[model samples]
Target: MISRVTQQTVQKSTLANLQLNLSRMSDLQGRLSGGKLITKPSDDPGGTASALQLRASQRAAEQVARNVDNGIGWLGTVDSALQTSLDSLRRARDLTVQGANGSMSAQARDAIAVEIEGIRSAMLSEANTSFLGRSVFAGTSNTGVAFAPDYTHQGAPGSSVERRISSDATVRVDVDGSAVYGQGPWDPVTATGSVFGLLDQIAADLRAGLPISDHIAHLDTRRDSMLGELGAVGSRYGRLETVQQGVQKTIMDLKGQVSAIEDIDLAETMVELQSQEVAYQAALGATARVLQPSLLDFLR
Candidate 1:
């Protein structure tokens, strides 16, 4: 038996092949214009999933980088305040030694006391230092100032403000105010309890022309405490800088991963697009010649 081939069969097959070629051309054009290998999940399911995962990781890393920056800001403010406090204390020590001189008359002693009072006021200002409207040394306290006018510590002990810089890393941004400034008012039973109170005592003795040589020892002790805090602040600053560098590197790595998964290579895409275009044109010309009506076919 001989099978008869119909003209309708040839026409249907030709149209289907042409439609497939057109579809491929359209897809290549879209990829070229969009500059992405995977515009939709159907384009490349495995690549799409990988790109999505990489993007999520990138976003998370970027957020951690932001946390590192915020932590750095808080620590920087703390470092500056501690430095200013140390300088003020050193000046106070120099003035205290001058007032302790026995040759100084009552008039000169009174002047020294007044100057000490001024230094105390300045130190009080430093104690109450605020950064971005919040007290940096206040240990998460919502109080407007870290210390009150009378030098009472408003921040709680062992409390700290912190930020997460990575999955395994956290940084403390706030310091303990009581540790830096003490509990305020002096207790007669225990000497050198509060820096402010110690200064007050020194100033009072100077006003009465009393020997302040003994007070110099207390001043030196308080200076040592301030220096210790300055050291702690400096340590925190160095840690933040190190963490920042690590966070930046993590962000950049995540970005590169995302680009490799989701983004297209322009040169490769251009070459592929041109090849697809030529193939589609060839398909169209072949289909035209195959479907064209001949003199014998028209008579049939």
Candidate 2:
């Protein structure tokens, strides 16, 4: 009876060791198959939390990048319009200068005035530029044309809009059209009126055969004002571009961070997985040998 009891005890111990080795092999298999140790919170609470945070940051960064893209598009429209405005103003100024010359007859000056009027009309049309159905120059108001039908600015003074590109980064989405188109330290129009208005007045003086040296002189001053406004618009364009670059950099950094948190290191993971596979194979071999023992072998 004592000998039989000893045999039973040995068998039970061998079975327990076999079960333990098999469990270890199963764990190794799991690790080899799944690159990450924490597929779920139950697998590793801290890793799960960290991954969640990283994913969240990545999503936020993507959305901000979209915002930056939209802002850049809007800025591009403004830049293009300002370029057109400058060109038109230059042409108008030339016409004014030509008309002011004494060698030209009144008929010639009047003919030139017609052309100036055309340029002025074109400038007015340009001022009403829109982006995605919203007025680029309409202060904060997006409902309609940037300028009134009479070519006056059509929104609240000093109203501006902004867009966020990152947690700490933001940029203004517009520069006032009135400011860019006329005179200012930043007035949208001159005391006399907008560029179109001044051009109309100049054209009228030339048509009436009135002495237009004074009109030309006023236009030259307004030309300087227009040039100043163009410079300011150019500066704003540069600033928006600078902010866009910053947002791009921030997006790149955030992408790297996200990759670090969520993406597997392929080289390292492959090495670890190979190691786990070898370990599991070794454990399987050991357990097979241990569990292969039979009653006949024991008797022998």
Strongest candidate by lDDT: 1
Q: List the residue pairs that clash in candidate 1.
A: none
Sequence-dependent TM-score of model 1: 0.91
lDDT of each: 0.81, 0.70
TM-score versus the correct structure, for each prediction? 0.91, 0.76
Write the residue-wise lDDT of candidate 2 on 113-189 in tens digits: 89988998798788888888888888688657777656668756889867786578667777777765552222223
Query: In candidate 2, residue 167 scores what lDDT?
Result: 70
Q: CA shift at 172, candidate 2, in angstroms?
A: 2.4
lDDT by residue for model 1 over 24-129, one digit each (tens)? 8887788778877788898889988888887888788788878878888888888787788788778888989998788988899888888888888887787777
- Please identify model 1 stretches exceeding 4 Å from their true place: 1-4, 294-297
